[model samples]
Target: MSKKETKIYKNVWKPGTEDAAKKFGFIRPEDIIRKNVQKKPTSKIDQILTGWGNYVKSHFVELSPELKAESQKRLEICDPCNMRDRGTCSTGRQGAHVVTGKLMKGCGCRLAAKALSPGSVCPLGKW
Candidate 1:
């Protein structure tokens, strides 16, 4: 008997509350996807975070000290390794979400974790 292929359902992160957006820096998945479609990122996490900060700084008012502190704390706790299970090695497989139609692979951030609030930043671009 041959094993049948199992179907995987696409998992979508929905914002649970308005406060969740504030906690997670509130960037829409659509926006992220649009940016991704325009240009592929070839930088590492640190650089990406730096660029993100710069972009946010340019647009929004300077982050409050409290917000900055919180952001730093979250950044520190972010471990891309435990988010996904890809085998013995957890480094390469960061925030990979296997959904039914949409597939997000090689994403690294808390956005991939269930711990993140529904609307928490999705490290992966929109599907």
Candidate 2:
């Protein structure tokens, strides 16, 4: 994909930002047109269920300043990720009603809270 494709995420991009295109290569059509293809949301109900299970496995894992710091480190990466949307992953693959495989929305978790919790992990391993 091109910088042009970032627009789908509401980012502003110039077609021929000479310096940036030169640096990123993919931004230049001459380099790669099919670059940066959006990935398939691969998390299945089993994964979401697994994520939730981790949440339970780590039960009683209380919050500490360190955990907050750890979660922040993860969220920082998430903020700029392509699949991130409204604090959820685009690959909430099983859909919103995913527990039953009946929706097309983002990952249902409130990322800030969940990422901070020991009970959860990013389905995409981004964090």
Candidate 3:
């Protein structure tokens, strides 16, 4: 066959993996093979709180806390949430952003402000 014709034939008739396995001894890797990478488990609170801010914004009307006691309770829960930072949350997992020269959080809300809002409900039901 001409060089071009031989090349085209070879391309068209390339062996399938299964066929190659039979011809040249192949072994699939074992399914249970372990890798060396170690990773930490995600916080349960953080996972639970995901997407909660958006849900609250749509379903609840923001209100100023009627009782200092109520705000304090909410703040206690938020203070340790995995998604929460100094005052912001990992809403989009980016932590925080500055808008109008003021900082806002990933969840599109700040925990301190949101916790104090009378009508706001905790997405994860912590408060």
Candidate 4:
């Protein structure tokens, strides 16, 4: 066969039977044998929280205990208010708030702010 014809035939007849097996939950003995391999357990929530914490830490400075407490209070108050008024702060307009420029501006998280602020006793780092 000509190269072009052969290429076309190969493309059209490419093997996709494994995909059908996957759809039907049919596993080859080799695959079953491989299943005995040890695998680490993954933590979905830990992964997500770790990613979020890292992102927050990268942006802000570490915080102090007092500041952390205040931020936590602010977050607690902000949560209900946000839920009532669409996921934002009510007073400062700085925490996912939609009204002011300061919206989404503050750490608003006790642990996060504590970890991101400069001179913070939080043990994380400066913002």
* Best by the lDDT measure: 2
- Segments of candidate 4 deviating more than 4 angstroms: 1-61, 82-87, 90-127
Tens-digit lDDT string for candidate 2 (84-120): 7788776544323324444454456756656655545
Clashing pairs in 3: 63-118, 91-106, 91-107
How does candidate 1 fare on TM-score?
0.25
TM-score leader: 2
- In terms of lDDT, model 1 sits at 0.41
lDDT of 4 by residue, 21-127 (tens): 54544544576466556544535444446535643755585645675555555445445443223432123343433433233533333433332232332111112
Model 1, 1-127: lDDT tens digits are: 1122111111122434534543454545675577469865445554456545543573666745664554455444443434445322234644444333454454444232322122233344322
TM-score of 2: 0.38
Evaluate model 4: give its TM-score. 0.22
Tens-place lDDT per residue, model 3, 3-122, is 875565455444354455434333223311321234345454443353354336535755344544676787787787766667765565432222234333345466655654555655
Q: Which of the two candidates, 2 or 4, achieves a greater TM-score against the reference?
A: 2
lDDT of 3: 0.51
RMSD of each: 19.4, 15.4, 16.4, 17.5
For each candidate in turn, the TM-score is 0.25, 0.38, 0.36, 0.22
Candidate 2, 51: how far from true, in Å? 11
